[model samples]
Target: MLRTLYRALWWLAAPAAVTRLLLRSRQERGYREHIAERFGCTAGRPLDDHAPLIWVHAVSVGETRAAQPLIEALLQARPDARVLLTHMTPGGRATGEQIFGERVLRSYLPYDVPHAVRRFLRAWRPTLGLVMETEVWPTLIEECQRRGVPLVLTNARMSARSFRRASRFGAATREVFGGFSRVLAQSPADAERLLALGARNVTVLGNLKFDMNTPAEQVAQGHAWRAAFGARPVWVAASTREGEEEQVLQAFAALNVARALLILVPRHPQRFAEVAALVARHRLRCERRSSWAVDGAVAGTAEKLDEDVQVWLGDSMGELGAYYAAADIAFIGGSLLPFGGQNLIEACAVGVPVLIGPHVFNFTQATADAVAAGAVLQVQDAAELARTLQTLFSDKPQRTAMGAAAAAFAARHRGATARTVEVLLTLLP
Candidate 1:
């Protein structure tokens, strides 16, 4: 009865959900493009009889990138298998196009209404379902189970706060989570949480984000960008969120370090203009990557700025590795403002020393491991962050040591992708 009520509530919210999508379309136009796919009107895609169709749902850019290694492994191991990738956000869809091209079928995952879910299942007929990190929808799980489609939640994690909220629903939460055939957790704590939430067959398979490699081309591009800047004391504040940018800018200004450059990459593309305006409000000259030359030179003489640009706004998409590569030190943002945190693993992968603020509950295990490994530094707030950067800037040896430790730390956490794929193989027919 509770399940039926929940479904009815979702049905009633359909109009509001569409309205939300239309509002979001103002910032990212892809939200308006695939209305039919969101309703499960996907058709005309050929299915291979010999090869099984495996569906993977990665809701946004972060999960989409995290699933890359797994997707590649599936295609490599099962030569006959066809992969269908679905996402809830336009950025994820655009990223899918950039990364996978026509190799996999791409679509917006239908809203979790029974009609839409049924239409989706009938259209795709996937042999198994792999959902990335904590995207459990009751109706989707129920429909998948009814259709006899085995579902696995990979890189799964439940925060203490999230667990408490789920506890409110009592048996319904348990029923939803319990329906999964398996849950591959990111850590032991996550496994415990999942078990308490009524999940069965849980395994601690580590984090898939750890297994994703920084592309070689992106690394080379980083070198080019560094060359463009030429010997400026460069640092990156990556995946920064709003309200945090003003903090970052203030922290950077406090340092007052001469000839220093900050590469600020906001978390969302829609916020690029807003961030640029923030930079102006702070009286800092900046360069937006979108306006910056793609093939031309850095527009200045060697080891000198043409106009003393203080910040390089990373407004373009799909080049995070380059940003990480081009920096001497990295500050993982979103942590400063109780926004959980952004992934710091990419910085570690590229051998850059990292700093993160106090609130990193979203990536608890990873942050703890990185801190223990001497791969990252934690600061109390923007003020301490500025002090730490200044201290590190004055101490080259400490920075070098931290960077080496970061690279080693990332290397030690690999093999999760292989383990995840091994479990996935068992679920496939």
Candidate 2:
């Protein structure tokens, strides 16, 4: 009865959900590919038949990125073990498929209704289930437990705000969380909170995100971008969200961004057109990143006073490493306008000078440590953000020094992947 009620609530959230979906449908066909996930794909045939599979759910791009090393580790350990990947968003699914390529089987997670959960489980019949981060589906966990499937939550975290809300439904959340055989959290803070929520066997395995190994190919590509941009002081607003872009654009306009590049990559690729409209509304001369070099941006020059603010609309997908590589300084977005901020660890791990806003609750543990390591600069608003960027632009020495500190912080925090894999191996049959 409780599961049924919770499922109803998910259905009720659909109107607001569908409304957003309709708004994002303006993208090209390639971007709209994940629409099949949310709608339905009727699990037709078993894609991997040789061995036992593990279903890992990563809802969006961030989670998908975090899950990469774990997925690779799994593949290494169990040559016969299959990965049946499912993502809530199309962008995530695309990224996973791109990263893993044909090495793993991928699909959309069925909706969380009992029927959908049953349908998903029956089709995959995975021997084990692992959810990255805070994806606690009551029905999914309960059903998996019923089937004797070992369940685990990897590199998990729950913010203080979320802990409070989940505490409200204390009984229910606790019962649902208890279904997990293991909960490997990013911090002791996260583990303690999960313990409060009735999750047993919780441990602090640290952040696997910190264990993010900068891909060599990505660095090589970044070097290529660095050559193309050629001494034009550059900064990237990587993973900017709806309201955050306007703030970044407005600040850039005020900061004489015409002289340098103010690149904006929306968190979701679906929002590319809507963001482009917002850019044009600001009257900035914008160009798609896909058409790089075609815009004929001359190197080693400054924007004239009368020139329009040349906003590089980063419409391309799955090349963030390229963006990070291209920028001398970086602002990790989602913090300024409040989505708890995107992970600065990505930019920091690459040793790029990093900046973020105050609302980095999502990465509270990691960001706090990064700040202590002098790996990040916190800007209160657009003004300070501009000043910070300006300072970094002029003070190349300081920026380079900060970048090294960030990389060291990243280096010191690796090994979580091995720890998590060890946990997974212990629980698996």
Candidate 3:
């Protein structure tokens, strides 16, 4: 009865959802481009006759990137396997294009309505489905189950807040979660949460993000950026969310440190212009990476930013490594207001010390482990962030030691992708 009602509610909300998508398209035009795919109405490119399809649904950029190592492992293990990648966001689709090119099939996932999911499954007929992280759609799972297409939840996690919300539905939550053939969790604590939610087959497979190898060129670019900064103290506020940027700007304003340069990277591509406007509103001179010419110049060159440019807007996609490499300290955003925080593993992988806000329930275990490893520091608010940055700026030795610890912490967590791939192999047709 609950499941039926849920579907009914979703069906009733279809018009509103379409309107929402239309509204979002105004800011992000890519959302408007793939209209047919979202309803599972269009036929994608014809499938290969010799190879079987292995589907992976990564909701956005983060989960898509997290699934990278596992995706590569699947491809290497079975050269005959064709990948069907689906994403809810344009960023994920763009990242998929950049990484996998024309090798894999990419599409916008259908809305979690029954008919759309059925149409999607009917069209593609994926042999196995791997839903990255906690993107469980009840109708989609039900359809997959009914169709005998095995589905596995990979690198799964649940924050306390998310757990509470799921628990409210009682058996409905179980019905959805129990549909998964297996749940590979990031931590033991995550496994416990899944078990309590009535997931029968849950295993702690660590974090797939740890296995994501940083591109060497990206790291080198980071070194170049650091060199470009010369004697100035540099820090990065990476993957920052909506309200948090204001807090970050305010904190930087309070410090009034002339030599301290901030590389501010907003989480969403659509917000680049907005963030730039905010920087201007704060009366801070800033240069955008997107606006930078391809003929790269150094600190003393003609193309160099004026010393008055206080913040460097990291507006480009897929170059986070460069920002982290150029920083003395790193602040992982999305934590300041209550958005569950962005991934800190990338920062750690680049050997940068991290500072985050108190709300990191999404990365609960990783955050705790990092702090225990002496890799990350948690601050209460923006004022505290300013004060902490001030202290770290004055002490170079502490930053170096912390960076080393961060790298070590990231290194120790490797091998999850291998474990995850092994489980995936078992489900293949």
Candidate 4:
């Protein structure tokens, strides 16, 4: 009965959702493409009948990237398997293309309405489905169960705020969560939360982000960038959310280091121009990454950039590893104004010292673990973040030690991909 009403609500809201997507396409044109897929109209080539279809749904860029190692492992294990990857956002779809290319079948997951999901399932007929992170769609789950598709919630995490919200739904939440055939959590705390929410067969499997192997080419690109930089102290503010950029720019304006370069990469591509403008407002000499590419390559020598450029706006995509590699220190964003922080594991994987803001409820266990391992330092606000950057910039020995610790911390948490793959394959027929 509850699900019926929920479906009704979604039916009513479907038009609004379509409108939102169309509006978002103004900033990101990828949304404009693949319109039919969102409504469950899959017009692509027919699926290969001989190969087993494995479906994985990742809503956005982060989840999509986190699913990388797992996807690769699954493909490696089942050579005859065809993975169907679904995402909600244009950025996620774009990132999928950038990472996987023609290797995996990609489509936008339909809005969680009965007809759309039914059409999607009918068209694809996946043998098993894996929903990444915390996405729980009641209608989709119910439909999957009705069709006998074994659905698992992989790399599951439930933050305290999320737990409280789900608790408020009482039995409805439990019924939805109980629909999953398995729930592989990132931590024991996450497993406990999932169990409390009535998810059965819950297991703690650590974080898949920790298992991400930095691209060797990107690492080489970072080395080239660093060489071109010629000893300028470099720090990157990676994946800064909306409000956090203002604070970060303000703090960068007050920094006292000589020839220091701040690389600001906004979390959303839509805000790239806005962030570049913000840097100009601060009166800092800025260079846009998109402007200076040479010979069809994104990164060229630093001589292309003005010596006085204080900020290098990271406006390009799929080069985060290179950015982290080029940096002496990295500040993970989305935390300064309470958006729950961006992933610091990427920077740590590159052996760069990391600093983050106080609000990290979204990544509670990972952040706590990183701090305990001395790979991360938390600052309360922009002021403290600036102060820490200044101190760390001057103290190379401490930064070196912290970088080593960060690398060790990342190395220690590997093999989640293997563990997760072993568990996932067991569920397959």
Quick one: best lDDT, which candidate? 1
RMSD (CA, Å), each prediction: 2.1, 3.7, 1.8, 1.7
Residue-level lDDT of model 3, residues 23-55, one tens digit each, is: 988888887788888888868546555467899
Q: Which of 2 and 4 is ahead in TM-score? A: 4
Tens-place lDDT digits, model 2, residues 113-226: 666677677777788889999998787888888888898998899999899999988678889899999999999999999999999999998898876676776676666656
Q: Give the clashing residue pairs of candidate 2, or none.
A: none
Which residues of candidate 1, in runs, are more than 4 Å off? 44-50, 296-307
Runs of candidate 2 with Cα error greater than 4 angstroms are 10-23, 28-50, 256-258, 293-309
- Cα deviation of 82, candidate 1, in Å: 0.4
Local distance difference test values of all predictions, in order = 0.90, 0.80, 0.88, 0.89
The number of clashing residue pairs in each candidate reads 0, 0, 0, 0
lDDT at residue 131 of model 3 (Cα atoms): 94
TM-score of each: 0.96, 0.90, 0.96, 0.97
Q: Global lDDT for candidate 4?
A: 0.89
| lDDT score at residue 359, model 4, on the 0-100 scale | 90
CA displacement after TM-score superposition, residue 52 of candidate 1 (Å): 0.8
Q: After superposition, how far is residue 304 of candidate 4 from its true place, in Å?
A: 4.3
Sorted on lDDT, best first, the list reads 1, 4, 3, 2
Name the 10 consecutive residues with the lowest summed lDDT in model 3.
294-303
How far in Å is the alpha carbon of 253 misplaced in model 4? 1.9
